[model samples]
Target: MMDFPLKPVDHRVLLPVMMILNGVSLATAINLVVSLDPEDKITSKRGSALTLLGFIYFMSLSEILNMTALYTGLGHRYRNKFRLNSGDVLDITNKFVSAVQAAFSCVTGAIVCLWSCTRDFMRTSHYMSEAYAWFGAAYFFYDIWSMYIVHLKMYSKRRPFKNGSTLLSSGDGASVKKPDTSFLAYCKHEPVILMHHLFIGGFGFLVIVYLRGDLGDCTFGFVYLMELSTPFVSARGILSRLKLKSSRLYLINGLLMLATFFVCRVISLPYVCYLYSKVIGSSYIDAVKSLPTGCKISISILLLPQLYWFYLMCSGALKMLLPSSAALSAGDAKRRS
Candidate 1:
């Protein structure tokens, strides 16, 4: 068992999971590469295979490193100098892991999107698109599993933190601890986080499964755009963990978050949907309708949370920018006096 949020996780479980995902990802890549048509020159096939294989290898290795950092608490040093409670430490670590994932997503997702966009869909290379989608599927599968594990711990029946001691010592020779409470109490402030994770993860898996071949390049471009706001989300987390809520950095990040959320998630997704609709609505497609309505509906439904979240993010930012309730109340008291 892992220690109270701060202790090392059970490597037995962790290592095996990483190994399995890596093995499966690599195997899939190899299979796809090997299945290339015989008509192509052997030399060209070899070059293409090696390129795809290299990407798969890099993606796997990057995942391994990311997971390792999270499980091992590799960057706890940055949390030093601040007196964080156990709850704060846990929250910060959670966000830190998210930041790492977001960073990866922004990088690789951008690459995938750029690569896809450079190719004309009518002339899109099927093998290249499959390679990207397959690799993305593997990564998101692992990500969702990891998120579910964390969600279970957070939402479990019992309190998830260490008992007997309110303080957990960090590597920086400082001890910080906070009182633990039940999940219901914990989620009172931000109840949507878990649901957001579940929905996003669910749809991501769906895209991997059913739409990988049909809509790989298009969906991927749309998907990667959603990650544009994630880095800002992660930054907000880091600032919150360090108790920098009143700082300018937090304020700036919040504004950036709103802009990116609107541009990337709120706007970009619907644009992709519009393009999808345009394709399906065209005169040529009227002769034979192959695109399913349900898939379109599902993709549209994914935008619902984005709208809600953007609202919340904007509201929060405005609230922060405005006078505090306490401040307003204090002024009222002074005027009355």
Candidate 2:
């Protein structure tokens, strides 16, 4: 397990920061619900608003779990158990798992966003839209915060390794082993990997744009594309840096996330078309009615990917920062000769 640099003050500050952010999300959700027009009673807009509320609540809950795991040192246990050795198998398995997790997070976010947007489209209410926008913003902020913590933990772990004896041999009879890779190394090419996710998202957005006559459909498509692609892009960048060969367990996880993304996109097409019809001034309001089913299926498919990706990200970060105590044993010292 990796050692963390968290002081008492750090915990105190982080707790309040998380709380304030989550509280704002909750308040925004409530405001959206409360501000709904009385005349729009029991419409799709109400459903969408409610869905947004549920998602925000869940996101807050997830963040709390993450914080607890990080602060209480449970995160250390998880990392210790799962951290990959340098010679681990390179397989497609982890990639698949990551892909699945990415897909799941996207699906989950999409459903919540879609539900809110659908409700608004049905009645032209801005409450759902506002709530949806706020939810996305809140999520982005939380993700950034979490990523920072993960980075800090990684660096703290790396310090010991950096100060330890060399692992490799050089021509001068000195050790030449490079320090284990850092999490940043694993994620350095993230921007490049994110391009694929962006492309997919752009495709979704363009499809929605074509259906502009049905504002509801357009909204759903836009949110779905945004929600689904953002995490995948982010994860892709992270995965790219890890250099988990196609055969590694983590690679398989990533592939699963990717597969989920593909599946979710396929499932969403019909709904997209329906929304498009509505957008083009077609009286086919019922086109969007079938969207809930697809959305639900997508949500279910996305669950595994989300859990796995989170696990990998946490574990990988720790591995990059902290070398196992065993790596510095007398035997290892002798091996350097």
Candidate 3:
């Protein structure tokens, strides 16, 4: 969608104007959808048609945002300001887009979660959740394509080739890429992420449209709120790619990332279970034990990966904040000497 190559005589004048114009339209559309009367729009027979409109609305917005970023000097100006190579610029561009998408998803998730929680945590249904599911599903499709572009570009860039090295060298001594950078390669390298996206976009979409039956919007809302931590993840990627790991902002963001991931992605699931326990007037342990086998398996599947990721995050944070073990041992040896 970002194919605009014609920069106006002075794009600085045009950029903000374009962004505001698009932003207003996007906001207006969201407000309209959010304000829909569930009885009139959702419970009615035309509910399906309205949601189709919602899906197209968001997909169009994604395209427009991409074009805005391309033509508004958003990505190009950043490249000029930072003096980063073109090879890394696309990654930065995608990160900017990813951050924006994550922000929107987080906001919509918050809206759904709040509205549903205030009613009833599990059984009560809300139009907001119903509406935003289309957008969330659209994003999963868009993001998968965006990420594949990143991987393709990264692997296509010149990589070093040495004797007994992973990379191969062209006959003229120029470096070449190792392994295929095809879609299959991307799928092979990222099975977990692929499954996660498919599970949410496919299975979650099933829940929203077919299986939910006006109940469990609260559960779906909680699922949407899982994106709460995603903006931090995107920011961390952008900062790391810019070689800003030692900066104060990076450290602060890392802290926030870990905290948000723990709260939004990890603890949020258990919190839902606790809420369920309270709803059923049962003890937490008993409530958990009372869950169906399928439910227990699903929760475990989600929670285990989160726990593993949290451990890795903590390890990375310690490695960044504290002295390395090698450095500590060297210091102790010097003192002894």
Candidate 4:
């Protein structure tokens, strides 16, 4: 949906534009922090402000680091993981930026989850902590959109995945390879990511407006779970870039990712369903009925996608755990013969 315009452009334009957008995002974050009212009752006051500031600052720093790494290849020194040749600079940078964003998001989410669970556990309906979550979501919306656009442009060029071949290269000369696939195949895989961003962005906006930065602690808890698997996801990317996917570390990280996704996203869905139902049953009019149509829809829409994503996660976990299933079957057939 975001790629409506298929016009061609010089790849040279992308780098500067991306940098400017990142700068704009940084400016927006600073503005929000500067405009924050210390005496505001809608927030946890100093705590919320500090959290928001930290998140924004970290995000800005990530953006700057991404720009510098992409432009100057400064990231190559970080164990020399990335391969930034003339042919794949933009694509590689996009992946690097996303990995960084995901890592930071995971950290921020962990902090929010801990803070909310510990300090404001009892306050489940209306309180100030929601603001912090909302603020983070707002930043995430822009971040997702920006990356989506960059990748969309980068993926615009067609490739032949069907005729693709993989080679084994070793020693210090090893480099990461981009997947060989048509734009359509890329499109097919990307919607889930784009949709996730869209939903979260919309949900965040609604939370800011109708909920007024207060979903109580309970609802906010489930929402925060969305980021629980992010660090593992990011780690997998970093490891892949470093060409460690076949190592024990990659396997361990993959296992952790699977477990975290199951615990955070899969298990939390049913629990949230139960909790939301209970809330509606307790005060139907005040909680459910009073909500705007969009807000109600946003909350309801979160469950189905999450359930589907969990199913995908489970399928992936099975495949990862049983990576030699085909080989085992072949061995069994040979023995029988």
Q: What is the TM-score of each candidate against the true structure?
A: 0.60, 0.41, 0.78, 0.58
Ordered by TM-score, highest first, the candidates read 3, 1, 4, 2
lDDT string, candidate 2, 107-136, tens digits:
535554456445655434333333334333
Ranking under lDDT, best-scoring first?
A: 3, 1, 4, 2
lDDT, residue 159, candidate 3: 57
Number of the top-ranking candidate, with TM-score as the measure: 3
Least accurate 10 contiguous residues by lDDT in model 3: 38-47
Give one digit per residue, the lDDT tens place, for model 3 in 218-239. 7666767777777888788889
Report the C-alpha lDDT of model 1 over 161-266, residue by residue, as the tens digit.
4554344456797866643444455455445664555555556544543444544464565675577788789789779878899998999899899898899889
Candidates' C-alpha lDDT: 0.57, 0.45, 0.69, 0.55
* Candidate 2 positional error at 302, Å: 18
Candidate 4 Cα deviation (angstroms), residue 80: 6.8
For residues 37-110, could you state the per-residue lDDT of candidate 4 as single tens digits? 42233434543454455455445444444444444435445424444332233334445555555554554455
Which pairs clash (backbone N, Cα, C closer than 3 Å) in model 1? 86-177, 86-178
Q: In candidate 3, residue 162 scores what lDDT?
A: 60
